[model samples]
Target: MFAEADWVVKLVMIGLIVASIVSWTVFVAKTLELRKATLLANQVRQDADALRSLAEAGDKPALAGSAMVQGANAELLLSADALHDPEGVKERVASRFDRHEAQVARTMTRGVNVLATIGATAPFVGLFGTVWGIMNSFIGIAEKQTTNLAVVAPGIAEALLATALGLVAAIPAVVIYNHFARQIAAHRAVVADTAAALLRVVSRDLSRGTIAAARG
Candidate 1:
């Protein structure tokens, strides 16, 4: 059917094929990316939970480059100049976590929008190909002045093939796009939990410092 398809229909089929390729490519890449990041995030969160205080989170070689670690470290430095006030420190750390979470979400969401675009537009693009194929077929039939089933079948079949390709390209794109959305949301939640855990560490460290100052 594709072999005999009109030039316009062929172009539509090629475009749909490219869209399908792009959608699957994104799926594979994101699956790997999300899997790796989630594992790292979870590990970092667990390590942060086991710490006695932010001081115990020192160096963080194992947790290096993690959003939780970076946010906590940056805020700890900035908060130190505030006279180790726990309330001020925790508030600032929380703000940094918010930005870090947003940044992580934006990073994870990269390239996912193409899936949505393919899913939403593929079917309509196929419909256009189908319409064009059928219109061309009708024009030929009119010129030939023939109503034979054999004469009518091929054109109709070719036109419908465009719609089929469209659906083929569209359905999985929609499904994968939704799957990525859920994955990203789950990762975001993990990040929030990590932030909260580090916040507790920050508070614990400040409390100990305050107590030591009182004794001194």
Candidate 2:
């Protein structure tokens, strides 16, 4: 198996090993990032829910922990007399929440592209190594002026090894990439839910403020 493989095929195998290592690293990093993002998004949802309850009770200060909530509260506080403008209040809160959602999504998506690229390329790299190995094996047979199973077996074995190695690298990369993608999608959903909760809080506050103004 060793004798039939040319220098080029060996080099390709080395390159594939490097690629596999890199792809694995990206998978690990992305998994960690997605887990962290999911946790943070859950926290945000809880915080937003609490803020919504406070708003329902005519208190906007309950949203102090969340920057999106804080911005909404600040806006409501600033325009104390503009109680009739529920639409404006809703828009401001939605905008702030959207910005936060975008930020969170950006963080959650990190390293995913690297994983994706590795998954797509690793197989081709392995195939190249196999092709190069087979060519070298044929060249060796030609030079030796003999076609023997023993002589050809090594080259074929090396080619198959290269293909196996490529698959070994690629399969994990593809799996991890898909896993990360699902995590990101879930993260986005949580963020969107939190944003909706924030909007509700802001809208409730606006409605209460309007009623108070009419009474005055």
Candidate 3:
């Protein structure tokens, strides 16, 4: 059926097929990336809570395997006077966590725009092909001087095929784009919550350090 299409129609079909393929590919990649990011966010939140509990119990064990904890630890180690101003220390620690959270959000949402583009523009492209096919059909009718059904049927069929192909490519792309949008928004919320948990731990530690310094 595609081979019988006019050259312009053929190109349109090919473009729609490629767009569909790209949309599905992005869907798979984004799904995996979001899953990983969500898991990491959960792990970081749990580790931060554990660290906070340990601090309250007077046992500050080094936390490993969590980016938020590792970043806070690095900052604390680098600045001996970090606790001199508790607010300043909290700001710096929160900044570090925010950076990591932003990075995770970006990673989870990469390639999602491609799906949006395919969904929004594919149907229009297919419509163009249909219009072109019908125009050619009308031209053939004028040149051949015939209103015969046999002569017109093939052209109309080819024109309608373009519209069908367009819908076929567009429907899935739109559905997938919406799905990822929801998932990404939820993942970002999780990351924000995890960042908040880490910030609480940093604030508590800074407060303790400031009190001890004042007594010294």
Candidate 4:
């Protein structure tokens, strides 16, 4: 296997290995990041709800003071107001949702492109190495002025090695890319659910607050 490939093919195989490793690292890192973001968003939404409850009770200072919680509260308040005139509120809520969706998508998609690139390109990189090895093998046979299998054996082995290495690098990348794609999809689902929950909680709070003010 070692004898069949030319140096160039070996180099390509090495490069493919490096690329695969880099892509996998990105996948792992980004997966963790997305998970963290999802958790943080959910926590912030929950805190916002608690703060909204306190606010409705006329409690002083609440979690709404936190920047993250404040944003969620503002979004909720804006949405509840727009409910009375949906046409006006619809645009604003949709715009806010769009921005949040974009942020969630950006977080989920981190590092996936690199994984995709590795999956798509590694096989071809291996093929190039095999072709180069075969060419070198043929060249060796010609230089020896013989059609002997022994003269061509080393080049063929080198070509096969590169091909094998390419597959090794590419297979994991493809699998990992698929795995992360699913994970990101799941994370996005969580974000959507949490955002909806936040909207509902805020809507209720707004209604209560309005009733209290009316009675006073």
lDDT of each candidate versus the true structure? 0.84, 0.73, 0.75, 0.67
Better model by TM-score, 2 or 3?
3
| Model 2 regions lying over 4 Å from their true place | 1-4, 52-67, 70-84, 210-216
Query: Candidate 3, clashing residue pairs?
Result: none
TM-score of each: 0.91, 0.81, 0.87, 0.76
Q: How many backbone clashes does candidate 3 have?
A: 0
Name the candidate, 1 or 2, with the larger lDDT value.
1
| Residue-wise C-alpha lDDT for candidate 3, range 1-216, written one tens digit per residue | 577778898999899889888988888887887788677666655666675532332333323556666676677666655467777777887889889878877777679878888888989998998898888788879989997877777777888888888888889999998998899888778777767876776677666664344223
Q: After superposition, how far is residue 129 of candidate 2 from its true place, in Å?
A: 0.6
lDDT of 4 by residue, 99-131 (tens): 777787885776687777888888899999989
lDDT by residue for model 2 over 1-216, one digit each (tens)?
A: 545467877877887788789887887777776777677668777767775343433343333466666666666666566666778767766887788888877877776777777778888888988888788779879988789887777888899888888888888888888887887888889888977987786676566654344223
C-alpha lDDT (0 to 100) for residue 187 of candidate 3: 79
lDDT string for model 1 (123-177, tens) is: 9999999999889788878988987777777788989999999999999999999
User: Residue 36 lDDT in model 3?
Assistant: 80
Highest TM-score among the candidates is held by which one? 1
CA deviation > 4 Å runs, candidate 4: 1-7, 41-69, 75-87, 205-216
Candidate 1 — worst ten consecutive residues by lDDT sum? Answer: 207-216
Model 1, residue 21: displacement in angstroms?
A: 0.8
- Backbone clash pairs for candidate 4 read 4-154, 4-155, 4-157, 4-158, 5-158
